[model samples]
Target: MHVDLTRDSVAMGDDVDAPHRQSLHLTDDASLGDAVSAVLARPYLAQIGGGKATWLVVVDGTVSAVVAQQWAGPRWLADARVRAPGAIHFRYLAQRDPGEVYVEYSRCQGQP
Candidate 1:
């Protein structure tokens, strides 16, 4: 299943077919943390996208390397908080890498 979270809502899906995917509309009014928790409520496999995230290892990508990297986690979310009314994007990685995950949030440009 795929899970997504925004500043105000959470969505989930179980398949590649967009029309047949599933989601849980948690709320329209929420904090970033709340949205994340709501997303965690669902079940999934892994991640691919990292927004100011840290990973010990990455594979199959062009930049496949064993390296340690970290970013301003809270500050990025803080930026998102300031840019409210944003959208959450969630997707599944390849079936071979079910242990991967991808989660991201971004406010529409010029929407202050």
Candidate 2:
């Protein structure tokens, strides 16, 4: 899995209104793990007090899935789980609002 850091917006707990942007490039298919791992590995994720990041899983020029991660705290705890090839669900923060983000597989679209 090749994970690309498309966008990173981070704001510390004290300043939720202010966020900084970070750009990262990760192109090694061998080192890339699941969506959660990839998101956690972002270089700037650990430095932020709290924020959201979006990743695009690109395979041969097409985006297979979109991953969104939001986290806070010293440990940066988050829950990211994939139920299917194109489906992922995750939750963060004290509210624990689960977010279901996925992309329909191109091959499986318009089929029975």
Candidate 3:
């Protein structure tokens, strides 16, 4: 599966003061697990001081899942909820108080 990351798309939440949205482009062949790991590995997400980051995952120009990562304490956490072609979400939590959180996802080459 191949995932593309871009800052081009924006989705506004109910709050008028909410930040602009970002999105992740996923190929039809992309797996949610792989895509989530790629986003979590971004260096910008490793910054200190807790904040929320979200990305709308789109497949073939259609929104498929919403991935979010947040940190506020000793752990950095992320999750993805798929809304197309399936219904599922995965949770990732790592201790981040004294070290970095490493994200790695592995799957069979022919599997999705």
Candidate 4:
């Protein structure tokens, strides 16, 4: 995914105020909810791709999910975002027949 470091944020702990929180733009199909659980468990991404950056999935101005995915290899440089590895969860939010995926990340960890 084309990560916009200028538009990303991060909250270390369970503090009401996030230590670092900024608006990020992710072009990949991954969402935010996909990364929440993984991030909570481990701050860093194991592989790469979607999990590389912590994201918030927003659809129509509402938080639909959290996403995190593994990173891709160098061969995937052509379109890194499309090959991200991670999980997407929108259980709390209502599912749309055909919804959009928005991933907001702190940084863009390019493919190896």
lDDT of each: 0.28, 0.34, 0.36, 0.29
Which scores greater on TM-score, model 3 or model 4? 3
Question: In candidate 2, which residue ranges exceed 4 Å CA deviation?
Answer: 1-39, 44-50, 71-112
Candidate 2 lDDT trough over 10 residues, lowest sum: 73-82
Compute the lDDT for candidate 1: 0.28
Residue range with the least summed lDDT across 10 consecutive positions in model 4: 71-80
- Model 2, position 109: C-alpha lDDT score: 28
TM-score of each: 0.30, 0.29, 0.33, 0.20
Q: Write the per-residue lDDT of candidate 1 for residues 1-112, one digit (tens) a residue.
A: 2333212111253233343233445455554444434544554223334522222111112111111113222223132232112334332222322112212222321112
Off by over 4 Å in 4: 1-51, 70-112
lDDT of 2 by residue, 10-48 (tens): 334524422333333444333323443545565533332
Per residue, candidate 4 scores C-alpha lDDT tens digits across 4-36 of 111132332323432233233344665333223
Better of 1 and 3 by lDDT: 3
Top model number, lDDT: 3
RMSD of each: 12.0, 10.2, 11.2, 13.4
Model 3, 1-112: lDDT tens digits are: 2333433212233225232233555666555555655565654233223444443334444433334455322122222333222322222232322222222111121112
Backbone clashes (count) for model 3: 0
Q: In model 3, which runs have C-alpha deviations exceeding 4 angstroms? A: 1-3, 9-30, 44-50, 71-112
TM-score, candidate number 3? 0.33
